[model samples]
Target: MRGLLFSSSKASSPSNSSTQSPARTPVSTPHHRTFSASIQEEDLLYAEQVIRRWDLDSPFYTKLDSLFTGDRREARQFVKSVKNLQSAMHFFVSESASSEKLIHAQKLMQVAIKRLEKEFYQILSANRDVLDSESVSNRSSRARSSVSNSDSDEDDRISTWGTSVSDGERATVSEMVMADLKSIADCMISSGYGKECARVYKILRKSIVDETIYNLGVKKYSLNQINKMDWETIEPKIKTWLHAEKIAVKSLFSGERILCDYVFSSSEKIRESCFSEICKERAVTLFEFPELVAKSKKSMERMFRSLDMYTAILEHWPEIEMIFSFKSTTAVCKQAVASYVKLGDAVRAMLTGFESTMQKETLKTPVHGGGIHPLTRYVMNYLVFLSGYSEAVSDILADGPLQVHSPLPESYFSSMTSDDSSSISGRFAWLVLVLLCKIDAGAELYKDVAQSHLFLVNNLNYVVSKVRNSKLRLLIGEDWVAKHEQKVKQYCWGKLSFKFNEAYRKHSTWIISDRKLRDEIKISLSRKISPAYRTLYERYRGYFQGVDSVVRYAPDDLGNYLSDLFHDAGASGSTHSSSSSRYLSRGR
Candidate 1:
C-alpha cells in the first residue's frame, strides 16, 4: 500500500481502475514536463539487467519446488531479485508516464510477483515447521532487510520487523527462510499484490491455527448442542475448555497476532485484516465455549465448575483483550466478557439457591444427645469448600445484595465494613447464618427445653469449629467465631444447670437405679459438669468469702458425690437437699 500504487492485477494500467487508487496520480504531472522527458535519458542503461531477471521466463519458478526438498540457498536470492524488481517498478513509475521502460517494468512486475507468489506458497508450506509463530516472532527482528524506501511515511511504514534477509550466515536456516517469507510478502504488498499474498497466508495460517487448537482437544460445538447436553456429559467439556483456554490465549492467539503482524508489517491494514480474519473465529470458538457452559443447566455440583470457567477467563482477560484488540476481532473479547459475566451471575444464583435450600431443609429430627445436626454439618462444610477460591468468590459476591435476614444477630451484620457486604466474608457469613436460623426454628422438635437449648449449642459449636479450623477462618474473621462461641458456652451452662436440677428434684427419695445405667448417666453428666465446675471454681475462687462450705465440693468431690446419688432408699434426702440448695442458691 505504501509504494506507488501499482495495479492489483498482473496487467495493471493507468486506465484500469479495478485496484485501489492512490490519492495522487502515480504518474504525477511534473512541475516541469521536461523533468519527466529527462527520465528516459539515463535509467535505460540497466533496464535489460533489471527487468530480465524477473522476465516471467526466468528459471526460478521451475526450481521453487526444489527449495523445499533440495538446495534452498537460492531462495534468498529469489527474494532479493523480487525486491530489486519492486524497486525498478517504483523507479520506472516515477519516470515519464509513457516511457517504454515504465511499460516493460509493469510487465516484469507481474512476472516477478507471479514467481514470488509461487515461492511464497512454497516457502510457507515447506517451512511449516520452521516458521512457527514462536520461531517467527522470536527471530523476526533479526531479519532487517527493507523491501521499500527507508523514508516512506505511508501507513507510517514505521515498523521494527522488515522484509529482507537475516543479518548474517550465523542466522539459523529457519530464520533465513522466515526472512525469505517476510521479504516475499513485503515485495508483493508494496507491488500492490498484497491481496494474493494475504489470501494464501490466511488459508494456510488459519488451518494451522485450527489444527493446533483441535489437537489441544477443543472441539467446535453448536450452542444448541451444548445446551442440550447434561452436566455429567458437558462437565468434562468444561474442564477441557479450562485447559484449552489457557493454551489458546497464551500460545495460540498471541502467537498468531505476533506472526501476522511480523509477516505483514509493511501494511497495517493488511496485517490487521489478516490477523483478525485468521484468529476471530478460532478465538470466538474458545470464548464461546464458556458462554455456552454458563448458559447450560446449573446446580450446586456445577457451581464450582462454572467458577472455574469464570476464573479461567478472568485470569487471562487482559491477554485476550490485547490479542483480540483489533476492531474486526472484538467479538472474541465481547464473547469472553459475556461468558465471564454470565458465569458470575450463575454462581450468585447458585449461591442464592443453596441458601434457599438450607432454609427448606427436610431433616428436622433432633439429635438425641444434642450433637451436631445434619444440616449444620453439610452446609458448614460446603462453605469451607467454597472458601478455597476466595479471590473468585469475592469478585462474584462483590455485586450481590445483602441476603442476611434481619433476625440474624446484629453482631454478624455489624462486624462487616461497608465493602464487606460484597466480600467473601459477608456472603459466607450470610450462608452460615441461614443454616443457623434454620436450626433455631427446628429446635422445638425436641420436647425438653434443655435438650432444645443443648441442640442449639451443638450446632453452633460445629459451625464455629469449622470456621475456626479451615480456610473459612480467613474469610469469616475471628470476631465471628468468638461471638458464636460465647453463645455456645452460654447455652451449655443453661442446659447443664437445668438438667441437674430436674434430675435431683425428680428422684430425691428414689433409690437403686441400675448400677451400669447410673454410671452412664454420671459419665454423661460428668462430661458437662466437671470441666465447667473446675473452670468456675478457678475463675471465682474465694468469691463466697468466708463461707467455704457454700462451695462445699471441689470438682473431684462432686464426681465422688455423684457415685452415691442412687444409693439406699432411706438415705437422708435432707442433707443432700441442704447442700444442693446452699450451692445452687449461691451459684445462681
Candidate 2:
C-alpha cells in the first residue's frame, strides 16, 4: 500500500531503527553514488506520502489534527517518514546536491522538524502531572539502575514497559511522553534542528524551575533589599529558603537533570547543554539567598539561623555538585559554596561579637543576697543554647580558634591549653571562665567578704547547672562541673555561720513573714552547711564561758533563724526576748 522505504535489494528496513527507542532519529548512510542515483525514487516516493499531510495542495494537508498527536500509532510513522526523507537527502548529498528530489526532501525535513517542535512543546506542557519532579526523578533513578545492570537492550526493554496509564500495549502514556520527547529531540538534532529544540526546552523548563523555586519561597533579593529588612521580616524568609533548598537540590534540580538527561540521552552535548541551561540561573539564585541573609545585620540571635542555612547547604553540597556536574551549570555549585562560606563568616562574626561583648562587661552592681546575677543568667543561657549546635559550632570555631586575651589566671589557661584550647570544650570552657571572672568581680560589690563568696557560689552553681543539664555538659566535661561544684561547697562554709548570727541580730525583733521562703532557705542551708557547722560547733562548745549552759542558739537552731530573717514581720525586741527565754528553758 505504501512505497517501500528502500529497495529490497540494497537498503535495510527503516523499522529496524524503530525498535531502538522513540528517541532515535532517522540516520543516513554513505552508499555508492550509483545506488542512491538509482534508488532515490523509492526514497522520495515513500517520503512524499508523509509530506502530503503538510503539503498545501495535497488532499492529506487538511488533516487538522497534528500528524504526531492525532493517532498514537502515527508517532512512529512520523519518525519513519523523517528517516525515509533523510535517505533521499543523502542521495542528493552523496550523488547529486542539485538533484530536484533533494529540494523537496529538504522542505519535507523542515515540515517534520516544525511538526516535532510543536509536539515536543505540547507533550512537555500537557504532561506536567505525569512528569512532575518526584515522579520523573523516580523514573530516572530506576532507568539509570536498569541501564547500569543490563545491556544496551535495557532502553528497549524499559520503553516497552512504558509509562503509559492504560493496560496492555497502552502503558506508553507516562513513559511514552518522555520517549515522545526524546524522539522529537533526536529527530530535530539529527536534522540540524538542535537549536530550535533546545531553545524551546530551555525556555519552558527554565520557567518551571524558576516557578518551583519561587513557590518554595526563594527569591533574588538585592543586598539593599535584605539589608534594609529587619530580623522579623527576614527570619521567616530564611526558614522558607532553608526548607526550599532541600527540595531544590534533592528533587527539583535533581529531577530536572534526570528529565533532561532522559529526553536528550541520545546526544551528550545537546543534553548537557539543555540541562545546564534549565537549572543554572534559578538554582544559583536559589542557593544565593542564604548568602544574602548572612550579609544582613549580624547579631547573636540571627547567627543560628544563618548557620542553619549554612549547614543545610554544607550537608547537601554533594548532591548539588552531582546534579549540576555539567560545565555550564558549575555556577550553581559555586554559588552554594559561596553561601556556605559567607554564612559561616557571618556566624563566626556574631559569636566573636558575643564574646567581645561579654569581655567588655564590667560587673559594677551586685545582686542582693548573692543570688543569681543577670549577667550570669544571660551569658550562661546563651552559651547553653550555643552548645546545642556542637557539631556546627565546632566546625565553625575550628576555622577561627578561641583567642584568649583576657586577664585569666595563667594556671587555668595552662590547664586548657594542655588539653586543647582550640577544641570546642576549651572554647566553651573559656567562655565559662570569663563568666565566672565577671561574677567574681560582681562579688566585690558585697560589703561582707562572706556575701561576696556566696555571690560567686550562687552564680557559678547556676552556670554549672546549665552545663550539666544541656549538651554543654558533654562539650565542657564532668571535670569542669566537679571542680566548680567543689568551689560551691567551699563558699557554703565561708562565714556562712556569720550570716546565721547576723540574721538573728539584724531582725531579732521581727517575726517571720513568709513561712514558705523560710522552710526553703532552711532546707538549702541544712543540706549544704549543717554537717560541717555541727562538727565545728561540737568541737568548740567548751570555748564559750559561763553562758555555755545558757547558749540558747544551737547549730541546729541557726537554720531556722537564718531562714526566717529574710522573710520577717517587724516585731519588737520583746518578741525575740521571749523566744530566747523559751530557747534557754528548752535547752535546760
Candidate 3:
C-alpha cells in the first residue's frame, strides 16, 4: 500500500505594507516573535508512519536482507530488487514529506540514500558475468541480438535504430539532463535532505554527464534557449528516471548468486535494451559499461566463486581494462574512503572485521581455468592492517615513508629470474614502494636505506625512459600504444618534470579562478611529504599560486622571472637526478 503526500495550500493571505495604518491592533514586538520561533520544531512523525507502513511488506525490504545475506546469489537478487525499489522509495518518501514536517522529510531522504549504496560489497564480488557481459553487450547489436532479437536484422531496422545525430544533438541532451538534475538537487536541498541531495547529485553529475559546459566541450552551444525548455516537466521525469536507474542497478546486486546469475544471464537483453538502443553514444567508453557488467559478474561470483561462472568474467578483464588502465578510479575510491571515515571509529572497526572475512585465506586460491582471481590481495591486506586502526589509506600512504618487505624466501623472485618470465618484480616492487611512500609520507622512517628516495628516482627514470621511447615508437608502435597507453603515464614520476612545466604555464589562471584549492596544492607540494606526489600537488598549487602571485606580486619584467621559476621547476630533474642517482645508480 502507498501513502498520500500533503497537498499545497491554495488560499492566499493579505500582504503587509511597509507603511502601516491604524487599522490593525498592536502585536508582539520582533524580540517576542524571535523567541517564539526559536522553540519551533518541524515534526514529520505522521508522514514517517505512512512511509514505514507502505514499505513494510515491500519486496525491496525482503531483497535488502537477502542482498546482505551470506549467500552471494541471493544477496545479488536482493540487491537488484532493492535497486528497483530505490526510485519508488525515494519518490514516496520525498513526495510524502510535508513541507511542515521538515525533520521527517530529511530522515526519509537519509534512509533512501543509505539504501542506494547497498551495492558496494557486491561490486567486488567475483561473479563471472560481471566482466563478461559488459564487452559482449557492447559489441554490434547484431552480435548481441540473441538475448533481445534475431541476428539477421533487416536494413530498415538497423537504419531506424542507428539514426545519426550530430555531436550538437548529443550535447543538447546532455545539457537537458544536467539542467534537470540540478533543479532536482535544488529541490531536495530545499526540502531538508541537503546531504543526500548532494550525494545523488554528485554521482549523476559525474557518471551521466559532466555539468561543466567547458569540460563537456560544448563550446558553441547557446544557453539562450534555457527559458524556452520546460524545466519543470523535464526535472520530474529526469529525477524519476535517475531514481529508477539507481534502484534497478542496486537491486541487481541482491538475490542469491544463482538467482542473479539466472536473471542477468540474459545480459545481452539488458544491454541491447538499455544501452545499445538507448545510450549508444556512451557505449564507446569502456569504463562505463564494464563497471556495470562487472557488478553483474560480481553478484554471481559472490555465490558461485568456485564454479565456471567466474571464467566469463576473467576473460572479459582486458575489455574492461581500468583495473590496470590509467583511467584512475582513485577519485571514486577516495570518496568511498572519505564516506567511511565520516561514520566514526566504531564503523571503521566493523569494516576491519568485514575486510578480514572477505579475504580470509579462501578467495586467494587460484582457479584452474580462467576466472576472476583477486589481483589485490597484498593491497587488501595492507588496507586491513590500516583499517584496524581507523585511518584513511591515502593519509597513511600518500607521501609516506616506504616500508620494507620482510626478507622473502629466495623463491619469491625465482619465476621472474627464469628466462621466460617477465621482470615484473621491479614493477611490483615499485608499486608497493610507491604505495608505502604515499601512505606514510615516508617521513624519517627509512632514511637510513633511502629506499623511498631511490625508489622514486628509479621508477621516475624508468617511466621517463619509457615515455621517451614511446614517443619515439609512436610512429611504429603508434597503433598498439594508442590503444594501451595509460593516461596516468603523464603524471608518473618520470613525467613530473613535464607536468610541472605544464602547470607553471597555467599557474596564474588557477589563482584568479580558484585560489583556495591552489593553496592546498602548494602546501602539499612544498611540505616535501612526497616527491612524486609533489609534482602533481605542486603543479596544481604552483599554477594557482604562480598565476596569482605573478599578477599580484610580480611586475611585467618580474613576470619573466616567475616564468623562469616555472622553467626551473620543470628543469629541476637534472639537479634532482644528479643528487639522488648516487643511491641506486648502476655504475656507468
List, residue by residue over 260-328, the lDDT tens digit for candidate 3. Answer: 122222332321222222122222221122222222212211221111112222333343232222222
Q: What total of clashing residue pairs does each candidate reach?
A: 0, 6, 52
The residue ranges of model 1 lying beyond 4 angstroms of the native Cα positions read 1-78, 94-104, 130-178, 220-223, 368-371, 396-408, 417-424, 448-454, 489-494, 497-558, 566-588
> Per-residue CA lDDT of candidate 1, range 1-588, in tens?
334543333335545655655765356556655664455433443444544554457665355333223443344444455555556555555445566866766665676677678767876776666566555545544543433334222223222222333435223655556555666677688667899999999999989988888987887788789878877898888878888888788777877887777678788899899998888887887788777777777789988888889888889999899888888998988999998998988888888888778767865577877678877888887888888778887787776654655444556745678666555676787778778778887687888887788788778777888898899887778788777766665565545555765766576446655667766876887888789788866653442233233344557656654654665555453355555556555554
**Candidate 3's error at 552, in angstroms?**
98
The lDDT per prediction is 0.69, 0.70, 0.30
Worst 10 residues of 2 by lDDT: 1-10
Clashes of 3: 52
Better of 1 and 2 by lDDT: 2
Worst ten in a row by lDDT for model 1: 153-162
Which is the better candidate, 1 or 3, if ranked by TM-score? 1
What lDDT does candidate 1 reach at residue 82? 51
- Evaluated against the true structure, the overall lDDT of model 3 is 0.30
- Model 2 ranges with Cα > 4 A deviation: 1-40, 50-73, 145-174, 406-419, 448-454, 489-588
